[model samples]
Target: MRKTAHRMVWDIFLVNMIIITGMPGAGKDEFVKVAKSMGFLDVHMGNTVKKYAYENNIKIDDTNIGKFASDERKKYGMDIWAKRTSKYILDEDITIVDGLRNYEELEYFKNNYDDIIVIAIFANEEQRFERIIKRNREDDIKSYNEMKSRDDRELTWGIGKVISLADYMIVNNKSLEEYKSDVKSLLKTIIDSRPKIREKLGL
Candidate 1:
């Protein structure tokens, strides 16, 4: 079937999406913030999981939420989170998806979207732990042991494989200002290099 005029226009203008995958506290949130400032909409997979748990009356703790996500993956396949989160994605020029934890999820988006780029943010374990402790979100790991356990759970879900397969990798081990600068510059380059986006932005 031929495409509608609106569909053709969307295809012409939108740059599609960027997938952000990183371990907990690897600055995925910061990356989203920068992307948002650059006019990209975002859908966070973790928030999707948490919202599902909330509506189901499941206690919103790390363990319960993790188990729910894992069980869903086991039942529906490894891309379950991606399936759920995709509902929240908007038809924007560029959408940044955060909290991608596994290879199947990556493949789900790649198979569905026309243009997708996966970016992995990396920080050494020590740095990640320090940042997690400093940030102290309610669901964050409270100790090194808990962080280790969380890492193991994520690895079991194939996060390491996804990270290894990322199209771009950003090391977020420096000062926040410097890291933000690097992220901004890299995102700008990615956006500017897109032919349609370049024309849209008058570049």
Candidate 2:
């Protein structure tokens, strides 16, 4: 019984978490899709906020959604989004958290999880803008000025700092196939590193 209980504890601690941080339209969704295909459970912070807004009947436009997210941070502290989204994490051995926008959110995961990896995806502004335009999500800004404003807002939330401090970075400025290949390689590296991590933990 003692050995079984100890093994259970080790298994629990062995779970690995990957947090994805990037500017809007920087291929985070694509990364999440790849991570999902690799069997990592996905939790998107922006989707959580949007769900909350929909539940409360808040307008879901770009400005309103941004304000709602900011208000949530102000009301519940800078880690509010992280705290809220964390509830979706289950007993999965690997989980991919997408849409981390601030350093406080990263800090929350660092303080809570023993095995956490931060991956940042980056693209040139022009590339990102073109992707955003092509995606045409209702909440996306329609103009370059609006996109710039959104970038400023996100940067103010410490996204740039989070990206700078990432454990790994994927530059998504190339073709789709190239980006996907890079993501797949990174995922394999992360998955391959897990056994070493478990060994070090005496699991």
Candidate 3:
């Protein structure tokens, strides 16, 4: 009976979801990390990129990869990577998606899931660039040219279009406390709506 109860709880966890989006270094990762600590299951699209890249023999940090992805979407249509990311949403109470880089991805999920919500995080370009340098991951970029190029790629690929269309926007220009405040406020609203949303959408 206990095991069956656990399975039932786990199944409920599987389907709740929200997509977190922002320009590079807008603190989407940090926000998602906090969300994970709370109750949301954070899913980074980069994981899908790296995994799919590995499976397909494509380079993970290849120059022009973002552009390539955009072009591929143009040729192949929406949700190539989205389909992979969606898999992780199963069994998680709340799935928080990070790094939404195109409008196509937004529409795909929005069309498929009636309860989908896009949360846009934003910071000044200079602040975001500085934060990106601080992360210093393998993907951490150095030159302004490199960062600019990637910025151009995402911008041209309609990343901003989705960001601008987001149902909620959090401007993360100050300390984490300020960001947390916005998140908490938005989360309360989302929490309150959960019953209605679940019933309306059959989640």
CA lDDT, every model vs. true structure = 0.83, 0.83, 0.71
Question: Clashes in each model (backbone N, CA, C under 3 Å)?
Answer: 0, 0, 4
Whichever of 2 and 3 has more TM-score, that candidate is 2
Could you tell which candidate, 2 or 3, scores higher by lDDT? 2
Q: Name the best candidate (by TM-score).
A: 1
lDDT per residue (tens digit) for residues 13-76 in model 1: 2337789998988999999998887777888999999998899889877788889999989999
TM-score of 3: 0.81
RMSD of every prediction: 3.4, 4.8, 5.6
Ranking by TM-score: 1, 2, 3
Candidate 1: residue 13 Cα off by (Å)? 12
How good is model 2 by TM-score?
0.88
Q: Model 3, which residues run further than 4 Å from truth?
A: 1-14, 62-64, 196-203
Worst ten in a row by lDDT for model 1: 1-10
- lDDT string, candidate 2, 1-203, tens digits: 01223333332333468899998889998998887776677888988999999999998889999999999898889999997886676643567889888889988877766578999999988999999999998789888999999999999888999999999999999999899999989988876778853443344
Candidate 2 weakest ten by summed lDDT: 1-10
Candidate 3 least-lDDT 10 residues: 1-10
TM-score, every prediction? 0.89, 0.88, 0.81
Pairs with steric clashes in candidate 1: none
Candidate 1 overall lDDT versus native: 0.83
